[model samples]
Target: MKSKLKMKDEILEYTHKEIENIKESFCKEYEHKIQAVIEEKDKEIHAMQKKFKDLNEENTENKNEIAKLGKMLEDANKKIKKRDMEMYILLDENKKQKEKAAKKMNKVNELLNNLQKEYTDNIP
Candidate 1:
């Protein structure tokens, strides 16, 4: 009876040790899996941060381009105004020239009429 009780105690002790070892190993594996998951999440977060930075840079470049285009548009408008002023000056000068030509034509017509009257009187 004593030997049988000793054998039973030894078996129970061995089983308890094995259970403790399995628990420890499972806990270590679980910790390792959690660490892997955490590392993967960190990598994803880093990638997202890099993408955000790139997008911000692109946005800044676009803003700069828009500003440059705006400046160019303003310059073009100024040039157009200058061209319009030049065109108006040319038109004004042309109008003055036409007026002068009409005055000269009127004087020539008057001189021709006087010449015609003198010739007609002399013939009779």
Candidate 2:
């Protein structure tokens, strides 16, 4: 009876030790899996960060290009205004020349009328 009790005690002790070892191994495997998941998430986060940085850079470049185009547009508008002023000056000069030609035509007509009257008086 004493031998039977001692054998039973030893078996119980061995069973407890095996259960503790299994629990420890399970905890280690769980920690390893959690670490792997965390690393994968970190990689994804870094990739996303890099993509965001590149987009921000591209946006900055686009903004700069837009500013340059705006300056160019402003310069073009100024040139057009200058050309408009030149065209208006030419129109004013044309009007003045036309008036001068009209006055010369009136003087020539008056001289011709006087000449015709004198010739008629002398003939009579």
Can you give the TM-score per candidate against the true fold?
Answer: 0.75, 0.76
lDDT of 1: 0.96
Top candidate (TM-score): 2
How do the residues 59-92 of candidate 2 rate in per-residue lDDT, one tens digit apiece?
Answer: 9999999999999999999999999999999999
lDDT of 1 by residue, 1-124 (tens): 9999999999999999999999999999999999999999999999999999999999999999999999999999999999999999999999999999989988888888889989888995
In model 1, where is the ten-residue run with the lowest total lDDT? 115-124
What is the total number of backbone clashes in candidate 1? Answer: 0
Highest lDDT, which number?
1
Alpha-carbon deviation at 28 in model 2, angstroms = 2.1
Of candidate 2, the 10-residue stretch with the lowest lDDT total is 115-124
For model 1, the stretches where C-alpha displacement exceeds 4 angstroms are: 1-20
